[model samples]
Target chain A: MTKKLNVAVVGATGAVGSKMMEKLVERNFPIETIKFLASARSAGKTIEFNGTQYKIEEATPESFEGVDVALFSAGGSVSEVLAPEAAKRGAIVIDNTSHFRMDPEVPLVVPEVNRHVLKTIPKGIIANPNCSTIQMVAALQPIREKFGLTKIIVSTYQAVSGSGIAAIEELREQSAQWEAGKNVEANVLPVKSDVKHYPIARNVIPQIDKFTDNGFTYEEMKMINETKKIMEAPGMKVAATCVRVPVVSGHSESVYIEVEQETTVQEIFEVLKAAPGITLQDDITQQLYPMPIFAENEEATFVGRIRQDLDNKKGFHLWIVSDNLLKGAALNSIQIAEALLEDNIL
Target chain B: MTKKLNVAVVGATGAVGSKMMEKLVERNFPIETIKFLASARSAGKTIEFNGTQYKIEEATPESFEGVDVALFSAGGSVSEVLAPEAAKRGAIVIDNTSHFRMDPEVPLVVPEVNRHVLKTIPKGIIANPNCSTIQMVAALQPIREKFGLTKIIVSTYQAVSGSGIAAIEELREQSAQWEAGKNVEANVLPVKSDVKHYPIARNVIPQIDKFTDNGFTYEEMKMINETKKIMEAPGMKVAATCVRVPVVSGHSESVYIEVEQETTVQEIFEVLKAAPGITLQDDITQQLYPMPIFAENEEATFVGRIRQDLDNKKGFHLWIVSDNLLKGAALNSIQIAEALLEDNIL
Candidate 1:
C-alpha cells in the first residue's frame, strides 16, 4: 500500500501552477490533503481539485506548515522567498523557478536524467530545470549515455507560454490584431520586464530573456549551465541561442551534437526509441516527425529529423519538441516529488 | 549614360516573379522594353508595372527572341525547359529555380558574395542561390573574407512566404481558425506537393522541402551545397537545418560558425559594418537585434546577436535576418542582372 502525504501547490492560479494541479490529479499522486497557494491578489479564488473545491490561500511561510511536499512555480522572486520557508517547514520543495537552480546546495534535477541526486537534498529543495533545458536534456540524455556527448549547440524555437499566461493572452490578441490589419501590440513578450517589447505573432525574437554580460540571454545561460549541472558533465561544451517564436505551448529545438564515439542515425534512433520519457518520431518516408501543435499535451519528449552531419561523422542534428508547460515546467516538478515518494523519501 | 536592354520577366504572376517586377521598377534597371510571361494557366492576365499594364504571355522559347535579359522565377520544371530555350535565343537567363543551381557549368550566384563568377556563363544561364542560402552567405561573406572561413552550422526560422503566396494565405486563414477555436487546416505549407502538410500558425515545422536520401530536406541541402559553391570554398564545412515558421516575409537564421583565424566579437562587428549589402543591427545595450517582422520588406541583410563561443575562441554565433523575397530571391536576381550590366557582360 502507498502512503498518502500532504501536498501544497504554490502559484496555483498561474500557468505552470495550474498545470501542476492537472498533472498531480491525472498522475493519481497519493495525496492525503492538497492546498492551493497563490499571491494575495488570487488568494480568494476557488479551485476544483479531485471533484472537491479548495479555497486558494496566500502563500506565506506558515501555509507550508503541514505540507510534506510543495511544488513552486510562482516567479523567481516568489520562490526565492517562499521556497526556503517551505523547506524550513519540513516540506520538500521542488522549485520550477530559476532562483535556486544554480545554488550549490539545491539540486537542479530532471528525474530521468539525474534523479539520483535527490538522495542529498541539502537545502531541502530540488530545482526543476528550465522549460527549454528540460526537453533538450530529456531527449539527449539517452543519446549521451549510449554515445557519450562532448559538445552541444542548440537553437530553440520556444513557445510564448513559457513566459506565463499573460504572454499567451498577448499572442492571442496580437494574432487577432494581425488578422484585422491593425497594429500588433506587444506588452508581455520577449520579457515583460525587459525595456523593449516585440510582437511575437508572425515574428521570431532572438532574445528570450535579458542579456547577461557574456552576451547570452539568461534563458540561454540557464540551458547552458543547468544542462551541465544535470548531466554532471562540467567539462562538456554547451552553447545555446534561445528565440521566442509565436508558439503557445510546445518548445522546438534544432540541436546539433557531437559524440565521443562513432554512431549512425539508425543507432541514435534505436537508442531514443528505447529511452524513457522520449517518443521517437523520425520516420522520413511517412512524413512522421514531431510538431508543436501535436506535442502540446504530450508528456514525452518528442524527437525527430535525426540526421548525421555530412561533414563530421561524429556529429548529428535532431529536432526535439515537448510541451513547455508540461515536461518543461509543471510536470517535471511533480515528477521530482513522485521520485521522492517512490524512493520512500517523504 | 546606361544602355537600355529588353527584359523578360517569366512567371510574373507568382510571388517571386511579382517581386522581380517590383525590384526592376524600383532599381530602374535600364530597360528598353519589358514583357511579362507566365504559364498557360496564368496567361492573358494583365499585370501593372511602372503604371503601365502588360498582358501576361504564355512563356515559350519565342518569348525570348529579342529579349537581352530574362529573369526566370517559374517552378523548376518550367525553368529546366524554358531557361535553356530562353538562353539559346540570346537572352542571358537569370534562373531563380533550383534546376540549374547544381549544374557545374551554370554560375550559382549571390551577387554580393560571388559576382566574380558571373564572368563566365557556359550554360548561358546564371542560377540564383536558394533564398535562405543567399541571406546566410551575404551575412557571412564579410567575416569569411577577413578571417579565413572553416565551418558553418545554421538553423533557420523561415517565413511561410518562402513557399508562395498560397502559404501566406494559409497562415492567415489558420490564424483566424486558431482565433475562432476551430481546427486549423493546413494544405499548402511545409511543402505544397510534398506528402505531408502541417499548420504554420503558432506552430513550427522542421522539414521545409522534400526529404532527400541523406535525411536532409532539399532546402537544407541547397543551403549546404550552395553556400560552398557561392563562397567558392569547395571544402568548406556547412550544415543547415531549415524550418518554416509563421512569419509572413523575412527569414531569420541562428548561425554558428568556426573561422580559421581567431577573431573577437568586436572585430566581426567591424567587418560587418564595413561590408556591402549588410546592415549591422547588433547593439545589445539597446535591445536591438534583427527580427523577422521588422526585417520584412527590407532590402539589406540584417545581422545581430554576435557572440563568441564560450568554449571555443575561434567559434562564434550570429543571428541573420532578411526579407526572403527581397534579398533572398527577387532583389538578388535583379542584383545579378545589375552586376552583369556593371561588368558589361549583358
Candidate 2:
C-alpha cells in the first residue's frame, strides 16, 4: 500500500481554501492526518471534515512543523508570508496564490497540460497558475501541440466568485434585491474598497481587478503572461480581455486562435475530444454547448462551439467553460498533489 | 428644406419592427405619412405613436403603393417574399432581416460607418447588418479611418430579443419562474427548434443561431462577412463567436483588434471618446464602465474598459455594448430613412 501524506490546508475558511479541503477529501488524497490553518481572526473555529472536527489554528512559521504537504489557498499576502515558512519546514508546498507564480524558482503546474513541469519542483514549493489561465491552458494545450499556435485572442465572461466570498455574497444579495424591484445598494463597484459601486445583478462589468499601467487588468495580463510561461510559448501571440459577468461560479471564455498550419474545425474538435481532462460539447444543432450552471461542481474544463473562421480556415473559435474554483483553483492544486504522490515525491 | 418622404415600418408587432416605428418617430424622419404593416394575425392591431394611433395593415405587394421608404423587420422568409414585392413598387427597402443582407446586389449599410454603400442598393434593397456587427463597425470606423484595421476578433454576449418576440417571452417567463423557484424549462437552445432545451436564466449560452455545415453558426459567420462588407475591407481578417446571454436588451462584445498603425490605450480611448455615436465609459479607477443596464435604452453604442496588450502595444482591446433592437436594427434603419430623406433619394 502507498504511504499516506500528512497534509495541511492553509486559509481553511476561505472559499477556495474550503474547496481545496473538500476536494482533497473527495478525491481521497490518502491523508494520514489533516491540519486546518487560517489567520488569527478565524482561529478557534471548528470545521468538520469526514466526521472529524478540527479547530482552525492560527497560521505561522511553525504551522507546517510536521506537515508533509501544504496547500495554500489564502490571499496572496498570507501565502507570501506563510508559504515560504511551510516550505522551509520541509513541507512540499502547493501554493494556490499568486505570490510565487512568476517566481523563476517556483514551478507553476497544470497537470493535464504541463504535468511534466512537476519534475522541476525545486526542493519544496510549487505554484498554481491563476484560475483563468489554468482552464485555458488545459483546453489549448492539445491544439497548441497539434496545430502549433501562432496567436490567441480571448475574451472572458468570468463569474463574480473569482474575486472571493464577499463578491459572491454581494452578487447574491444584489440579485435578490433587484428581483424584488428594490433599488439595490452598491458597495462593491470596480473593487470592494473602491469609491463607488454599481448594479451587477443584470449587467456585465468589463473590468476585473485593478487596471495595470499598460491598461490591461492584472487579471487579463496574467492570462497572457502565464499562458506564455506555462505553454513555454513566449513568442506566441496572446491577448486577453477579462470581464466580470453576473455568473456565480464557472468562467466562460470566447477564444479565437490562429495556428501556424491549416486546421479545420472538425479536426480541432477531434483533437479536443480525444484530449485529456476536456469534454467536447459542441452540438450547435441541439444548443448543447457549455454553460456555467452546467459546469458548476465539475472538475474538467469544458470546450464547445468549436468553429473555423469563415475568412481564414487556419483560425478557429471555441467557447470554453469550467468551474473556476475547481479546475481554476482547488481541484487543480489537489491534482498537483495527486501527481506528487503518484511520482513518490510526497 | 428637404422634402419629407412617406415611410412604412413593416412587421410592426415584432421587436425590431416595434423599435423601427419608435425610432422613425423619435428621429422625426421627415415623414409625410406613416404606415404600419404586419402579418395578417397582427394586421388589425393599433399602435400608438406620438399621440396618434395607426392601424396596422396586412403586408402585401399593394401595401407599398405610395410608400417612398420601406423598413422591413420581418423574418427572413417573410422579407424574402414581400421585400421584392414592395421594392418592385419603387419604394427604397431597408431590410433588417437576414434574407437580402449578403445578396450580391443589396447594399448592407451601417449608416454611421458606411453610408456611401447605400448608393449601390440594387434589388431596391438596403440591408442592415446584424445586431452584433452593427455596433462593432460603428466603434471600429473611427479607428479604421485614422489607423487602418487588419484584423478583428469579436465575441458577443448578445441579448435574446434579437431572436424574436417568442424569445423575449421565454426569457421573461423563465426569469419569473427561476426567481419563484419554479420549474424553468428551456424550449430554445443550441437553437429553438432543436429537440433539446436548456435553461438560460442565470446562464450563458454559447450558441446563438443554427450552426452551418462549417461548424460556425450562421450568426458568427454573418458578423465576419458583414464586417468586411460594411468596413469595405474585403481582405480584412475577422472572426466571431456569438453567444446568447440572459440579458433582455443590449448586446455586449469583447472586441480585440490589431490596427495597422501604432496605437496606445489612451490614444484609442481618446479617439473613441471623440468619435460621434460612441460613448466612452471607461474609467477603471472609479469602476465605472459601459454595462448592459446603462446601455439599455441609450441610442449610442457604449464602449469601455479600453486597454492595450502589454506584449503588443499595437494591439488594443475594448468592451462594447448597445441596444440590439435600437442601434443594431431599428435605429439604424430609421437613420437610413432620415438620410434618404435628407438626400431626396426617398
Candidate 3:
C-alpha cells in the first residue's frame, strides 16, 4: 500500500497556484490531508479541490506545523521568508520561485532530467526550474545523454500566461480591444513592475524580465544558469533569447544545438521517441507539429520540426512546445513532491 | 536631372504590386509613363495611383510593347513567362517572384547590399530576394564588410501579410471570433494551399511556405540560399527557421552570427549606426528595442537587443525588424529600379 502524505499548496489563488490545485487533483497525487495557503488578504477565500471546498489560510511560519510536503509558487519574496521556516518544521519544500534556485544548497530540478538530486535535500528544499527552462531541459536531456550536447542556441516564443494571471487578462482584454477597432491599452505586460509596458496583443516583445548587468534579461539568465545546474554540465554552452508572444498558454521554442558525437537526424528522432515525458510530433508530410493552442492543457513536452544544419552535420534544429502552466510550473512542482514520496525521502 | 522612364506595374491589383504603386509615389521615382497590369480576372478594373486612375490591363507578352522598365510582383508562373518576354522586348524586368531568384544567370539583388550585381543582367532580368532575406542581408552587409561573417543561424517571427492579403483577412476574422468566444476557424494561414491551416490571431506557426526535401521549409531555404547570393559569399554558412506570428506587416528575426574578427557589442552598434538603411534601437537602459508593431509602415530595417554570446567571444546575437511590404518587397523593388537607372543599366 502507498503512504498518503499531507500536502500544503502555497499561493493557492494565483495563476500558477490555481493550476497547481487542478494538477494535484488530476494527477491523483497521494494526499491524506490538504490545505490551501495564500497571503493574509486571501485568507478567508474558499477554493474547491477534488470536489471539496477548503478554506484558505494565511501562510505564516506556523502554517507548516503538520505539513509533510509544501509546494511554493507564491513569488520569490514569499518563498524567501517561509520556505526555510517550512523546512525547519520538518516539511520538504519544493520552491517554484527564483529565490533559492541559484543557491548552491538548493537543488534546481526538472524531475525527469535530475531527480537523483532529490536524494539529499540539504536545506530540506528542492527548486523547480523556470517555465522556459523546464520544457527545454526536459526535451534536451534525453538527446544530450544520447548524442552528447555541447552547445545550444535557443530563441523562445513564450506565452503571456508565464507572467501570471494579470498578463493573461491583459492579453484577453487587449485582444478584445483590437477586434473593436479601438486603440489597445497596455498596463501589465513584458513585466508589470517595469517602467515601460508594450501592448502584446498584436506584438512580440523581446524583453521578459528586467535587464541584468550583462545585457541579458533575468528570464534569459535563468534559462542559461539553471540548465547548466540541472544538467550538471558546468561547461555546457547555452544561449537564450526570450520573447513574449500573444499566446495565452503554451511556450514555444526554436532551438539550435550542436552535439559532440557524430549523429544523424534519424538517431536524434529515435532517442526522443524512446524518452519519457516527450511526445515526438515531427511528421512533415502531414504538417503535424506542436502548436500553442493544441498544447494548452497537455502534460507532455511536445517537440517537432527537427532538421539538420545544411553545412554542419553535428548541428540540429528543433521546435519545442509545452503548456507553461502545466509542465512548466504547477505540475512540475507536484511531480517533485511525488518523486520525494517515491524515493522514500518523505 | 535623372531621365524619366516608362514603367509598368505587373500584378498591380495584388498586395505587393499595390504597395509597389504606393512606394513609387512615396519615394517619388522618376516616372515618364506608368501602366498597371494584372490577370484577366482583375483586368478592366481601375486603380487610383498618386491621385490618378489607371485601367488595369491583362498581362500578356504583348503588354510590354513600349515599356522601358517593368516591375513584376505576380505569382511565379506569371513571372516565369512574362519576365523573360518583357526582358526580350528590351524592357528591364525586375521580378519579385521566386521564379528567378536562384537562376544562375539572373542576378538576385538587395540594393543596399549588392547594387553592383545589377551591372550585368545576363538574362536581362533581375530577381528581388525573398522578403525575409532582404532585411537580414541588408543589416548584416556592413557588419560582414567590417568583421567578416563566417556563420549565421536565424529564427524568424514573420507577419501574416507576407502570405498576401487573404491571410491578413483571416487573422482579423479569427481575432473577432476569439473575442466573441466562438470557435476560431483557420483557412488561409501557415500556407493557403497546404493541407493544414492553423489559427494565427493569437498563435504562431513555425512553417512558412511548403516543406522541401531535407526537412527545411522552402521559406527557410530561401533565407539561406538568397543570403549567400545577395551577399556574394558562396561559402558563408547559414541556417534559418522561419515562423509566422500574428502581426500583419512587419517581420522580425532573432539572428546569431559568428565573425572571423573579434568584435564587441559596442563596435557592432557603431557599425550599425553608420550603416545605410538601418536604425539602431538598442538601448537597454531606455527599454528600447525593435518590435513588429512599432516597425510597421517603416522604411528602415530596425536592429537592436544586441548581445555577445556568454561563452563564444566571436558569436553575437541581434534582433532585426522591418516592414515586410515595404523594405522587404515594394520599396526594395523600387530601390532596385533606381539603382539600375543610376548605374546606366536601364
Candidate 4:
C-alpha cells in the first residue's frame, strides 16, 4: 500500500499556487488530506480538487499543525515568515521563492539535477529553482556530466506569465489596445512598482527584475547563482541576459556552453536524448525545433538547434524551452516532494 | 550645387523596393529622373511618390541605357540575371540582394562602417549587406576601431517584416485567429516554402532561413560572412543565431563580443556616443534602453545595456536595435549611393 500524507498549498489563489493545485491532482499524488491556504484577502475563496471543494483559509503559524508537506508558491515575504513555521511543525516545506534559495542551511533542489541533496535538509526546506533556471539546468545537467561544463552564456526569451497574473492580464489588455489602434498603458511588466514601465505589446523588454550592484538584473543573477549552486561547480563561468518577450507561457533560451572535454555534436545529441526530463527535437531537415507555443503545457524540457561552435571545438549552442509554470515553478516543487517520498526521507 | 543623376529602382513594387522609394523621397536624393521598373505582372501598376504618380514598367536590358544609378531590391535570381547587365552599362548598381554580396569584385558596404571602400567600385556593382548584418555592424564598428575586436557572438530578435509582405500579413491573420480561439495556420514564416510552418503571432521561430549542412541556417551564415566582409576582418571569430519574433518593423540583437584591449563600460559608451550613425541609450536609472516598438522607422542604430562580462575582463555585452526597413535596407542602400556620389565613384 502507498502512503497518503497531508499536504498544504500556500497562496492558493495566485498563478503559481493555482498551478500547484492542478499539478498535484494531475499527477495523482497520494494525499489523504489537502488544505488550501492563502492571504486574508483570498481566505474565503473556494478551489475544487479531485471532485471536492476546499475552502481557503488565511495561512498562519497554526495552519501547519497537521501538515506533512507544504508547497509554497507565495512571494518571498510570505515564504520568509511561513516556511520556517511550517517546517518547525514537522511539515517539510518546498519553497518556490528566492528567500531561502541561497540559505546555507536550506537545500536548493531540482529533482533532475540534484535530488540527492534532499536526503538531509538541515533547515527542513527544499528550495525550488527559478523558472528560467529550472529549464536550463535540467537540460544542461546531462551535458555537464558527459562533457564537463566550463562556461555558459545564455540569452532568454521568457514569456510574460513568469511575472505574475497581473502581468499576463496587462499583456492581454495592451495587445488588444495596440491592435485596435488605441493608446496602451503598462504598469506591471519589467518589474512592477519599479517606478518606470515599458510597453510589452509587440515589443521585448531587456529587464526582468531590479538591477543589482553588478549591473545584472536580479533575475539574471538568480540564474547565475542557482546554476553554480545546483551543479556544485563554484568555478563555472555562467553569464545570462534575461529578456521578457511577448510570449504568454513557455520560456525559450539560446544557450552557449563550452565544455572541458572535446565532444562531437552527435555525442551531445545522444546524451540529451537519454536525459531524464529532456526531449530532443533537433532535426534540421524536418524544420524540427522547440517553440514556446508548443511547450506551453509540457513537463519535459525541450532541447533543439544543437550545433558546434565555429571557432571553439569544445563549444556548442542549444535552444531549450519549457513551460515556466510547470517545470519551472509548480511541478518542480511537487517533484521535490516526490523525490523526498521516493527516497523515504519524509 | 549637387549633381543630379538619372536613377532606376528595379522591383519597385516589392516591400524593400517600396521602402526605397519612401526613403529616397524622405532623404531628398539628387535625381534628375526616377524610373520605376518591375516584372511584367506589375507593369501597369502606379505608385505615388512625392505627389507624383509613376507608372511601373517591365525592366529589360535596355532599361539601364541612360541610368547612372540603379537600386535593385529584387530577389537573388533577378539580381543574378539583370545586375550584370545594368553594371555592363554606365549605371552604378547598388544591389540589395544576396546574389553579389560574396562576389570578390563586388564591395559589400554599410556606409557607417566601410564607406571608404566606396572610393573605387571596379565592377560597378556595390552590394548592400544583409538587413540584420547592416544594423549589427553599424553598432559594432565603433567598438572595433576603439577597442580592437577579436570575437563576436550574436542572437537576433528579428521582426516579421524582414521576411517580406506575406509574412507581415500572416502574422496579422494568425494573431487574430489566436485571439478568437481558432486554429492558427502559418504559410510564410521562418522560410516560406519549408514543409513545416509555425505561427509567429506570439511565438519565436529559431530558423530564419533554410538550414545549411553545417547546422547554421542561411540567415545565420549571412551574418557571419557579411560581418567579416564589411569589417574587412576575414579571420575574426563570428557566430550568429537568427530568430524571427512577432515584431513588425525593427530588428534587435543581443550581442557579446571579446575585445583585444582592456576598456571600461563607460569608455565604450563614450566611444559609441560620438560614433556616426549610432545612438547610445544606456540609462538604467531612467529605465531607458533600445526597444523595437520605439525603434520603428528610425534612421539610427540604437545601442544600450552595455556591461562587461563577469569572468572575462575584455568581454562585453550590448543590445542593438534599428528599423529593419529604414536603417537595415532602404536607408543603407541610399546611403551607399550618396557615398558613391560624395567620393565621385559614380
Top DockQ model: 1
Candidate 2: residue B259 Cα off by (Å) = 2.5
Interface RMSD of 2: 1.9
Candidate 3, residues A258-314, lDDT tens digits: the string is 998989889888999999899999999999988999999999999999999999989
DockQ of candidate 3 is 0.83
Q: lDDT score, residue A233, model 1?
A: 97
Clashing pairs in model 4, backbone N/Cα/C closer than 3 A: none
Where does candidate 3 stray beyond 4 Å?
A: none
lDDT at position B293, candidate 1: 91
lDDT of 1 by residue, A11-124 (tens): 888899889989998999999999999899999999998789999999899999999999988888999999999999999999988999999999998999999999999989
lDDT of 2 by residue, B85-174 (tens): 888999989899888888879988887887877676778889888999999999999988888899888888888888887887787677
DockQ computed for model 1 against the true two-chain complex using alpha carbons: 0.93
Chain B TM-score, all predictions listed: 0.99, 0.96, 0.99, 0.99
- The TM-scores of chain A alone, one per candidate, are 0.99, 0.97, 0.99, 0.99
Local accuracy of candidate 1 as per-residue lDDT tens digits, B1-346: 2899999998887889889988898998899999989889989988899999889999988989999999999899999999989989999999999999999999999888888999999989999989999999999999989998899999999999899999999999999888889998989988899877889998999988899999999999999999999988999999999999989999999999999999899999999999999999988888999999999888999999999999999999999999999999999999999999999999
B1-346 per-residue lDDT for model 4 (tens digits): 1999999999877779989999888888998999998888888899897799999989898989999999999889888988889889889999999999998889999988988888778888999999999999999999999899999999989999999999988988887898889999988988887888899987999999899999999999999999999999999999998889888889999999999999999999999999999999998887888999999988999999898999999989899999998889989999999888888776
| CAPRI tier of model 1 | high
Q: How do the residues A1-346 of candidate 2 rate in per-residue lDDT, one tens digit apiece?
A: 2788889998877889878878977887798889999889998999988789999999889989999999998888988888888988999999988888888888889988888888877747899999999999999999989989988889888887787888887877776787678887767754775566776667777777777766678888899888988988789888898877777789999888889889787788889989989999987666568899899999989998787776677888888999999999999999999998887777
Q: Give the TM-score of candidate 4.
A: 0.99
DockQ in order: 0.93, 0.63, 0.83, 0.79
Candidate 3 C-alpha lDDT tens digits along B1-346: 2799999999887778889998898888999999999899989999999999889999899999899999999889999889989988889999999999999999999888888888888988999989999999999999999999999999999999999999889988998888888999999989988999999977889999999989999999999999998888889999999999998889999999999999999999999999999999998998999999999889999999999999999999999999999899999999999999888877
Q: What is the lDDT of residue B180 in candidate 4?
A: 86
